[model samples]
Target: MRGIAIRIHREFQLMDCASALSIEGLVLEMVGAATRRRAQGLSVRPSRWIREVKDFLDEHFKEQINLSTLAKCADRHPAYLSQVFRRCYGSTIGDYVRQLRLDYASKKITHSTESIADIATAAGFYDQSHFAHAFKIHTGVTPAEFRAATRKK
Candidate 1:
């Protein structure tokens, strides 16, 4: 009976150790999941960040603005800023910049007497051909054709 009691006590101690280990494992898992969720939450931002990015873009669209520069201005990582900008604005940063340039070019095409090449250059396009291709893609007309049409009326 004495031996049997000692064996039972040892068995209970072992079970207690096993239970403690199981609880510790569960606690660690819960902590890990919480950390992951917090990290994911941090990636999301308020609309103000997007507005800040848009304001910066509006100011610098005529210059060569890239993701890194925009991110720096916004105090965000490039990838994170890109993600938030797209989510809030429904367009990529590059697309937004391109649209701004095209919009500026269109205004120039209609209101100014500058040549298409010079307008393209002023709008931050690398050259006339590149501008024409991009313009056609966006506006469904070449820059000259669009210019002539706008000038007609």
Candidate 2:
């Protein structure tokens, strides 16, 4: 579990989204195993922790988040925190963060005259290229293309 957390954290810091997502899948598998074990005994409800983490993410999605910091805040191990979050929320933390960033960028694209690079930076992307790649993947269009298409509608 620690190893998985470490790998995911490393990939995330390097901005390797694909690697982070792949490692998160491993975390989900561990979560499934842990769930089965807990089902065999007394299962403690993690509703409060889940809610706290979700709220925190919702508020700070634009910030550079560290799993260790979040785990410490929630008083849980990083792996356990991620496992519980994925199990309950149906998405990895990285995916949720990216979705938040993309959602913000998309809104700015459609509603404002800000340049794509400016919007990307404001949305917490490391670079315009990375933002464009993610935006294309999410919406099937580059940021400029998306803007043009939306403007024509």
Candidate 3:
């Protein structure tokens, strides 16, 4: 992981953030490498298929996700996909998606002036109330309160 970070820093110095494709490629490689290492270092070895499912979820978390759809994409049965995903990642797919949305919304809430409704929409929530409820459950604070706390740093 440290080596990947150093390589990424070197790549950035050579070009800049303007080369978003290069940066993204580097990041993907780093994540893949790290995942492989984690699987090897852990008690259980994760399937390569689970890694593919994880990458897909990471890329499409903002979109509506259906287990049957994901199963088709992964070429696995929906029940099997859910089983492997939980074993490999230690969370259900739905919970992972919810966490991803909340994390993204938290970043935007702290750094951007967007309204809570707009952030909720962008984070793939159907409505602000739902987003707020999920966010508060995950973080133990409402979005507005979290933002204010972050801004004080």
lDDT of 2 by residue, 109-150 (tens): 989999999999999899999999998876556889878866
* Error in Å for residue 70 of model 2: 1.0
Clashes of each: 0, 0, 0
Candidates in order, TM-scores: namely 0.68, 0.70, 0.71
lDDT of 2: 0.76
Comparison by TM-score, 2 against 3, better one: 3
What are the lDDT scores of the predictions, listed in order?
A: 0.72, 0.76, 0.77
Best by lDDT: 3
RMSD of each: 26.0, 10.8, 10.2
- Clashes by residue pair, model 2: none
Give lDDT: candidate 3, residue 148: 74
Where does model 3 exceed 4 Å of error? Answer: 1-43
Q: Which candidate is the best by TM-score?
A: 3
Model 2 worst lDDT run, 10 consecutive residues: 1-10
Error of 2 at 111 (Å): 0.3
Across 5-108, the per-residue lDDT of candidate 1 in tens digits comes to 32233233334446455545546655665566456663355578678779978888989887887788789999999988766554678888888888788779
